[model samples]
Target: MNTRGQFLSSRLVNDSLISLFVVSTFPPFRISFQLRMWDWFQQYCPWVLQGISMVYGMIVRIRRKAYQREWLRPKHLSRPVVSVGNITVGGTGKTPFVIWLAHQLHAKGQRVAILSRGYGRQDPSKNLMVSDGKGHVKEWRVSGDEPTMIAQHCPWALVAVGPDRFRLGQWVLEQTPCDCFILDDGYQHLSLYRDLDLLLFDATDVKGLCGVLPAGRLREPLDSAKGAAAFIFTRSETLSSIQPVQTCIEKVIGQSINPIVLKMVPKQVRHLVTGEVQPLTFFSQRSLLVVSGIGNPRSFCDILTGCGLEVGEEIRFPDHCAYGQDEANLILEKIGQSDQDIVVTTEKDAVKLREWFSKDDPVWFVTTDLEFLAGEEHILGLLDRAGVV
Candidate 1:
């Protein structure tokens, strides 16, 4: 080949390599690129995603019918099981709601056991105990971030982790006494029969209910939610925000279902290393280098902003991200030795980030609780109806 042609080829290869490095090394770039590609596909080849979603919807309906027809009988444990789940993929605040439910059960002197699929765990196939109703028995890496966070919040609740929640619940019953079981994210787990199914939806996500799977965020068609004992909308601060999603849900159910609305209120901010909790007001007006690796990062940021903290810089990572020293270094670089600037994250991320950050670092995490804005009595009424209380 000619010298000019060789030079041009080398330049093209180098440019491609540089572009790949930027996309892989930076989270923002990678996420933006992925979104752009998905948008292009949706705009040009809409049939492909729609066709896949149609097939997925059919499979969902068939599986649901199997359970209904007793072709696939659901196994029930001796104890009552209450499931907290969502129709959409993620970010429904299941962990916080689970924690809240556990606390309520604990108040009634009922021994509670939390059964989880332990998504994002290193060895999800193996059944593991996260907390034995006293404290954590395994690390976050083994138990998964959401389960670990639940265990941390509800130390008095026994937490079991595995793919098969029925088997996990059985094993827990054998090892220890439990008055009831809280199935974490078990909406689609038809293998186990639940006494009460609490289906959750993010009120802010109006567009999420558009379709199923590849075409949209929904895991199953809207009709699947009809089986839920009661529907709960999370992050519902205003009526206007909740109306659109609620209307869509009622339209599909062919009835006026007055859904329960829950506002995720920030409870406290605790130092990761010292374990000292500061009031949410302590961070008011302070500059924050916000770091989050959760399903609804925008919700987290909005909560921080609502607390009157200034988000000077923000870094978003994929949901259930396993933090490392390199990521910590990158965060520290963003902070850049500013006394007024501090790093803030969600409690879920804190579980994994603690390994890379220490007491000396200006790192803290926010803890949130579910506050019922509407239909608080509905939850209690459902619990009573299910005979779980």
Candidate 2:
């Protein structure tokens, strides 16, 4: 009516406030509102993280009492090593339980190698190998994403990487005819020597064991798993939901241990460019689309929406993400304009999107394992007391 109808109603209220600030900055609404503000600072800042987890649990009990009195010893390697790790950082599946403990010591014939301080390697200080147990000759950014997804699922098992894992376990036990050595994420790698440390966790991480790095999500503390001898509980489902987490780990390491539980599942959906093996009812109710970079993308979208599928959309990244090809053509143009139909991910993001997908790309990858709901033969008697049977 007046000055050009008041400049067309102030440009329609500044274009609806710039479309609600770009739909609240998209990308899964800014990664689920920055993970609900880091889960309300790890659950209402436990009494303000008890004075920074008591000066970060007193430097993790003085670097674990300087590797227990020896003022730092740990460094042997003439075989026997076994160490699958985790105390709480994320993804406590520890590379699918170190490819199910390297297929239970490569199905009895023994001889498995793993080692890995590789986490997202590029030139992680050079020491490579990535696989010599038969495949993946190197490159998941130089063997990193969980040691290239455990050397593409234990090709016989021998995945290596460096940053000094006790000199990369004396250079993959002098390069091969190896007899043991698993170690990926070796329980805080206190310089090496490990005839079994096996401490993994994540039946929902017990409130991220209350504080260490940046204030929670412990990297140490929980007495660094008190020199772990048992405790394996990954995303459990049964065995009486692990009896109040085995009475809260026997009142936090005051003894009473023996707890295993496992139950992971989703054992393989494959095909990231023709390895095939698809049918898990072709992902049940379809319309899927779940991407990852892992470190618990909500337990990989609640274990693929509890296997029935129907994810709709999710694309998290920041946790070892490397998928190049301009991030696979922006994740194939956001799953080709939505309404999904396919695109699952996580054999650690399908080993970094197999050189960025191509051969008729429909892309898939499920592969999870760990099933021993109630001490399955007590994890083969702790891998026969770590001597690898």
Candidate 3:
């Protein structure tokens, strides 16, 4: 119609296009900036973080006390639930340990079902059955990466995901025959009563055990660890490496407790597309373009280096990162720049990246296993005593 009207419409369209471009392109930079700012705040503004942590700690204490005093009652399923969790916000090799435990119970002829909150999943369903004792029923995005990986490893075990694990367990029991349940990341989940709670700690991160929430990595006070039936020190390089953490925990719990020590060793490398298994020695001394979106990228890299692989470049994304075409393109660019290096990632990341990368891509994932350095018999005996087996 009018010239002014046309001018205004063109301007509006241009502005909208520019806004969309910025919104789409700014996320990676925004996430990086936010993480840096958070780290800076944690370091330089201790008083502020300490104040927030104090408030958070009070809430945690109140909720725990309510559960203990029966102000809030925990619901239990017909089958016993064995919880595998860590106090810290990051990884302590829980997936591998859960897979190991599931295999152990499965070998004993127990029908195991894994219950998880399915953190970072996009699905809004109340309860999603990830696997039905045979294979995955839902994709990784719907079931979350960790649960998908667990289901992939433990095909015979049923995996269910939902916020309310008690309801999820009930749903599983109603549908299938499950002898017991394995609660993943259930240390803070107080609504469901667990027959055995195994608390995990990263032995390498002893300093992270100092405070709660914003002040440190701990989800609750060190004293809360006493509620666990047993403690497990994961990524244990040696007894000396774990002694500091054990001492700190024992002092807070006001007693000495036996801790199971586990070393997460790389067992094999598997091709993500072809399902071809390769030994660790297959890639020894070769250059790798390491890509990971996990809580413990340093640990994963260390395992790679320990196996004699040179990390040519590393692309670290935030934990449980939902990979898309942008990430796939970035990874390909990095790989292209590297000098004949193979691409490597963690199993958790591989679950999502498999859809992004092709079958012909030189992408491999490291599969790790829990090697119990100590207290193996103690854990097995605890499982037996709890009637899990």
Provide the overall lDDT of each model, using Cα atoms, as 2-decimal numbers. Answer: 0.81, 0.72, 0.82
User: Candidate 1 or 3, higher lDDT?
Assistant: 3
TM-score of 2: 0.33
**Local distance difference test, candidate 2:** 0.72
Task: Give the range where candidate 2 is weakest over 10 consecutive residues by summed lDDT.
Answer: 1-10
Ranking by lDDT: 3, 1, 2
1-389 per-residue lDDT for model 2 (tens digits): 11100111111322111211211122445644655654576578656645776787798779888988888898888888888888767677877778877887889888788878787677888788878887756777777788877777677778888888888778777766788888888788887888878887777556666556556666777766778877888888887766665666577778888888887888768888787887667778777777676677667667777777777766555577665665576667766767775888877777778877876878788876677877868878888976777
What does candidate 3's lDDT look like per residue over 94-146, in tens digits? 88889999999999999999999997799746799999998656798898999
Report the number of the highest-lDDT candidate. Answer: 3
Top candidate by TM-score: 3
Please report the TM-score between candidate 1 and the true structure: 0.88
Please state every model's RMSD to the true fold in angstroms.
7.3, 19.9, 8.8
TM-score of each: 0.88, 0.33, 0.90
Better of 2 and 3 by lDDT: 3
Query: Candidate 2: where is the Cα deviation over 4 Å?
Result: 1-47, 50-52, 68-77, 80-112, 115-154, 158-182, 187-288, 296-312, 315-338, 349-389
